[model samples]
Target: MHRMKEFYLVSDRHIRYAMMKAFFDARMIEGSSVREHGVMMLSLVEKLKDLQADFNKEETYVDVILQSLPPSFDQCIMNYNMNWLEKNLHELINMLV
Candidate 1:
């Protein structure tokens, strides 16, 4: 049996900006140690950069549909919260497991 991983190449600044805005707007109690705000910001920024890359590149870094700017779990867990890492930590771990 084999499993495949999904990839996405989001090319919209609006989506990226929305995600950032939502995050800042969300006011949730969070655990400081478990979550690293800097890393998450970096990852999202990198995603935005990738989205801004040439649409007609010889070798594309991205190779899948851009669902959400930065894809999230199913609907049940969608929200704009600064403590995204803590809130969605389990969801992410579940994906790996």
Candidate 2:
């Protein structure tokens, strides 16, 4: 039973790591391409948190999301307030979605 639990734990960690890598490595898809992927990735992130995954900080995740945005978002990025950016990342994500 203990070994089975350990195996499950390792498997969960591996899955979480894979998802995180995929999200970070991904570029912004053209049009609405990233919306679905973003939603799925965000869901996976929330799920991994439930499993006690040592996820990256939300600020870093926000930065990654911002960077993944297309050139059209450059204006918004330039206008972004770093403090508000950290606090209102969901708003930014919603805009993209």
Candidate 3:
């Protein structure tokens, strides 16, 4: 566990991820294997870098406001998700009849 924490202390994100992978590969932790980590862990690094880039911006009111807006903001007409149930119970009843 000490070594795991030491590896995570490194500034390089990729190295941290690799160390995490090694820890999981050795079957050290339960309910969480490296295969289940997926791209989300790496995405955390990317999100941090993006925030850093946004922080680096040093400027006055230039004629442009560079901001990130949701891609489906105004274009979205519906926010609900449908499962479209197949009516399995009804099918079973029809078969009995």
Best candidate according to TM-score = 2
In order of appearance, the predictions have TM-scores of: 0.27, 0.63, 0.21
TM-score of 3: 0.21
Of the two candidates 1 and 2, the one with more favorable TM-score, higher being better, is 2
RMSD, one per candidate, in order = 14.8, 4.5, 18.2
Residue lDDT tens for model 2, 76-96: 777674335444445656766
> Could you give candidate 3's per-residue lDDT for residues 1-97 as a string of tens digits?
3454477665545554554444233321234432333233334334434434222322210001111112332122122113232323223123212
Q: Which candidate gets the maximum lDDT versus the true structure?
A: 2
| 10 residues in a row with least lDDT, candidate 3 | 60-69
Residues 15-34 of candidate 1: C-alpha lDDT, one tens digit per residue: 55655554334332233321
Better of 1 and 3 by lDDT: 1
Best-to-worst ranking by lDDT: 2, 1, 3
User: In terms of TM-score, how similar is model 2 to the real structure?
Assistant: 0.63
